[model samples]
Target: MTVMELSNLSVTLRRRDVIRDVSLSVGKGEFIGLIGPNGAGKTTLMRAALGLIPFVGNSSLAAMPLAERAMAVAWMPQQREIAWPVTVETLVMLGRTPHVGALASPTDHDRSQVDAAIRWMGLDDMRQRAATRLSGGEQARVLIARALAQDTPFVMADEPVAGLDPAHQISTMQTFARLAEQGKSSLVSLHDLGLAARHCTRLVLMSEGRLIADGCPAHVLTPERLAEVFGISAWYQDTEQGPVCQPLEVIR
Candidate 1:
C-alpha cells in the first residue's frame, strides 16, 4: 500500500525554486533514505510533502484534513530544540495529543504506547530526566521516541541522527529498519552515506532541486552517481554487514 505520494511537487522560497518537479511514492514497509548534498532540496521536499511550506503540485499527505493527516503521518523536523523543561516521559506523551481530543485526557493505552516508545529508543533510564538537560544525541533519541509514540502509519525525519555517536547512529538507523518490519513506512533524510546504504531499503537521491535517482542502495550509490551528485569518489563494497560506502576523495 502507498502510505504517501507526491507528484510534480515544487517549492519556492524568495521567488527562487527550491524543489522542482519532484514526484515520489512511499510504500508501506519501506525505509527510504533521502540523500543529497547540502542545499540539494532534501529538506524542502520533506517540508513540501508535509505541507509545512507553500508549494506547487500534489501531496497526498498535504491534502488530508489536518487531524486525519496527523494520525496518518508523524514528522520529526531537522531542528531539535526543547524550549521547555518538560520531563522526558511528559515530552513523549505529547505524541498522543492527536488521539486525545483537546479536552480529553490520555488513556491507559496512550501511556502504554509512550512507555513502549521510551524503551524502544533505549531511553528508559532517562525517562524521568528533564529533556533540556539531556545531551544532544540523547535529545535526538527522545524526539525519535516521541515520533514513534505517535503510532502513525508513516514517519518522516530530517537528519534524525545528526549529532549521535557512531554506535547510536547505527542503533537509530536500526530502529527505523525495525519500524519497516512492523509495516511502517519511513522517509528519512540522511547525510551519512554509509548508514543510508546499510539500513535503508531504498534510496532517493536529489540534486539541484530535482530527484536524481531512486532505487536500491547498491544501484543508486554508484561511483559515477556519487561523483556527479556529491562531487566525491567513494569506495563501495558488499560486506556481510551490508553495502558499505566510504568517500575516498572529493572529485574536484
Candidate 2:
C-alpha cells in the first residue's frame, strides 16, 4: 500500500521557496532516507507533508483530517525540546494520545504499547527518571520511543539519531528496519550517509529545495552525485556489513 504520496509539493517561507515542486511516494515496508546538505529543505518538506505549514500542491498525508492523520503518521522533528519536566514513562505515554484522545485515560493496551516502546529504545531503566534530566542522547532515545509507541503505519523522523552515540545510532536505524519488516513504512532524514546507506531500503536526495535523486543507496550515493550535490569526494564500497560511504574531501 502507498502510505504517503506527495505531488508537486511546494513550500514558501518568508517570501522564499523552501521546498520546490517535489513529488514522492512511500510504500509499505519501505525505509526511505531523505538525505541532503543542511538547508536542503528536508525538514520543510516533512513539515509540509504533515500539514504543519502552508504549501501548494497535493500531499495525501496532509489532506487527512487532523485526528486521522495523527494515527496515520507519527512524526519526530529535528528539535528535541522537552519543555515539561515529566517522567520518561509519562512523556512516552503521550504517544498514545491519538488512540486515547486528549482528555481520556489510556487503556491497558495503551500502557502496554508505551512500555514496549520504552524497552525497545533501551529506556526501561530510566523510565522513572525525569526526561529533562537525561543527557541529549538519552533524551533523543526517549523521544524516539514516544514516536515508536504511536504504533502508526508510517513514521517520519527528522535527524532522529543526530545526538545518539554510534551504537545507539546503528541500533535506532535497525529498529526502523525492523519496523519495515513488520509492514510499516518509515521516512527518515539522516546526515550519516554510511548509516543511511547501510539500513535504508531506498534514499531520496534533495538539493536546493528540489528532489535530486531517488534510488537504492548504491545508486544515490555515487561519487559523482556526492561531489555534485555535497561538493565533496567520497569513498564508498559495498562491505560485508553493507554499503559504506565516507566523505573523502571537499572538492574546493
For model 2, the run of ten residues with the poorest summed lDDT: 97-106
Distance from true location, Cα of 54 in model 1, Å: 0.8
Q: Estimate, for each residue in 1-252, the C-alpha lDDT of model 1 and write its tens digit.
A: 999999999998999999999999999999999999999999999998988999999999999999999999999999999999999999999999899989988999999999999998999999999999999999999999999999999999999999999998998899999999999999999999999999999999999999999999999999899999988999998899899999999877
Q: lDDT of each model, Cα atoms only?
A: 0.95, 0.96
- TM-score for each predicted model, relative to the true structure: 0.99, 0.98
lDDT of 2 by residue, 179-227 (tens): 9999999999999998999999999999999999999999999988999
Candidate 1 minimal-lDDT segment of 10 residues: 243-252
After superposition, the stretches of candidate 2 with alpha carbons farther than 4 Å from their true spots are none
RMSD of each: 0.7, 0.9
- Candidate 1 regions exceeding 4 Å error are none
Report how far residue 60 has shifted in candidate 2, in Å: 0.5
